[model samples]
Target: MTSDFVDVQIANRWLTSCLSLFGRVFGEDSAHYKRLNEQFPSYPKWPNVEQAYGVLLAAIDDFEKEALFSIKQLIEAEVFDEFLDQAEQLHSSGYFQPAAVVAGSVLEDGLRKLCGQHNVTLPDRPKLDWMNSELAKVGAYNKLIQKKVTALADIRNNAAHGNWGEFTSEDVTAMIRDIRDFMCRYFA
Candidate 1:
C-alpha cells in the first residue's frame, strides 16, 4: 500500500510538471495545453493516472515534432507587426506622442522575449534598460544595439510621462522604423 501511495505521488508530480511546461511552451490557450488539462484526473489513481501519463508523453512528443520554437517565433512576429501597424497609423494621424509610446512598448516587449529565448532570468517587472543591459552582457547583441535600446527606452519614458516637447514627430517616426526593423531581425 505504501508503494502504491508513493507511485501515485510520483505520477502526480510528473503530470503537474508536464502541465506547467506545456503552459509555458505552447501557451495556456493552446490546444496542446488544453487537451492535457482536460485529460488530467482530479484525483489521480490506477488506470486514470496511467492514462494521463500516456497523454502527457504524447503531448510532449507532438510538441517536439512540431518544431514549436520556430512556430512560437513566427506567432510573435505577426503579433508585433500588428502593434507596429497601429503605431504607424497613430503617427500618420498626428498622434505621434501616443505612437512613440506604443513603439516603445513593442521594443520593451521584444527585449523581454529575447531575454527569455536567451535563457536570461527575468525579474517580475523588468525594465527596458535592465533587459537591454542583461542581453548585452550575455552577448545577445553588441553594445551599439544596447545603446540604441537605451535611447528608445528614454523616448518611451518621455512619452509615457507627458514630456511632449522632449521629442518630435520625426523622432517618433524614426522610432517606429527602428522598432520594426529590430522586431523583424529578432522575431522574424
Candidate 2:
C-alpha cells in the first residue's frame, strides 16, 4: 500500500467510533423485535451487525476521500500567509525564541485549521504532539514531515521553558525557513 491518503488504522478507528454512536442510537443487539410474539417493534429497522459494519466501512472510505479532497482545497487557499510573514520578520530581527514560537504556532494553527476543514475533532487544548499525531493518523503528511514537525515542537517547547541553550539563533533561522517551506508546501 502506498499510504498516500487513506490510513487504515484511522479508518478502522473511524468505523469503530461510528459503530459506537450507532449502538447508542440502536440497541447493542441491534434487534428490531423482542420476540416473534411481539406485535409492535422495539427498535426501528436496522442492518445486522455484519451488514452495518460493512456499511460503516464503505461510508468511512467515502468520507475519507471527501476529507482528503477538502484538505487539499483548504491548503491551496493561502490560509497562513500572514503567520509566515510575521515569523520571517521575527526571525530576521534576531528574536530567535520568539521567531521559533511564532513558527511553531503557525504549524500548529495550520494543522488545526486543516482538521477543522475536514470535520476532524481535536482536543480543547491540544498540544503540538497531539495535533501532530492526529494529522499523522489521517495521513495528512508523511512520516518524514511528521518527524520534522516533532523537532519543531521540541524547539518551541524548549524556548517556552526558557531553555534557549538547546537552540541558537541559527537553529531558529532554520526553523523559520523550514516552517515557511512547510506552510508553502502544505497550506499556502
Candidate 3:
C-alpha cells in the first residue's frame, strides 16, 4: 500500500516475469526430466515438455496472481478497492473473459494516467497498440504490424485454450518460448 510496498511488489513481479520467460521455454516439467534416473535399458523416456509448459504457466500464474492480489491489497488500503472488487466479482461470477479484460484494462488506464502526469503523449499505447500504429511510427507503409498482431492473437488463443485440444506439449513450449523471445527482442 505504501510506496515501499508498491516498489517491492513491482520488483517481485518483475522477478516472476523473468521466471515466466524461462519457464515458457524450459517448462516446469523440465526440472522433473532432469531428475529422472533410468533404471532399465528399456525404460521409457520421461515426458517433460507438456508438464513443463504447464509448470511454466503455473509459475507465471503465481506471479500474476500474487501481483494482482497485492494490488488489491494496496487498493483496499488506499480505499480505491472498487476496481479490485470489480476484477474479482467478474472473475468469480462466471465472467472469466470480462475479468481478464478488466485486468488489462486497468493496467492500460494506469499507463494513460502516468503518461498524462508526465506530459507525454504518443499516437498510441506501447505494447498492445504497438500492433496498430507501429508501422506509421516507424515511417513504413506495410502491414507488418497487422501480421504481428494476428500472430499474437493466435498465440494468445493457443497458449490459453489449445493446450488440451490442438496444442501439443511441444507446441505449447515453442509458443510460449517464442512469445517471450519476441517480446524481448521485438523492435530492439
CA lDDT of every candidate: 0.86, 0.67, 0.41
Per-residue lDDT of 81-114 in model 2, one digit per residue for the tens?
6776787788787777887787787778877876
* Cα lDDT tens digits for candidate 3, 12-69: 4544554555445444454422322111112222232223345546645756667434
Q: What is the TM-score of each candidate against the true structure?
A: 0.69, 0.56, 0.27
Total clashes in model 2, counting residue pairs 3 or more apart in sequence or in different chains:
1
For model 2, what is the C-alpha lDDT against the true structure?
0.67
Quote model 3's TM-score: 0.27
Model 2 steric clash pairs: 78-188
- Sort by lDDT, best first: 1, 2, 3
Q: How many clashes (backbone N, Cα, C below 3 Å) per candidate?
A: 0, 1, 1
TM-score for predicted model 2 compared with the true structure: 0.56
Best by TM-score: 1
Q: How would you encode candidate 1's per-residue C-alpha lDDT over 1-188 as one tens digit per residue? A: 22224366776787788789988877798777787676566666666565666777777687678768786888889999999999999999999999999999999999999998899999899988899999999999999988888988898999999999999999999899999998998888
Residue ranges of candidate 3 with Cα displaced over 4 Å:
1-80, 124-188
Q: Estimate the overall C-alpha local distance difference test score of candidate 3.
A: 0.41
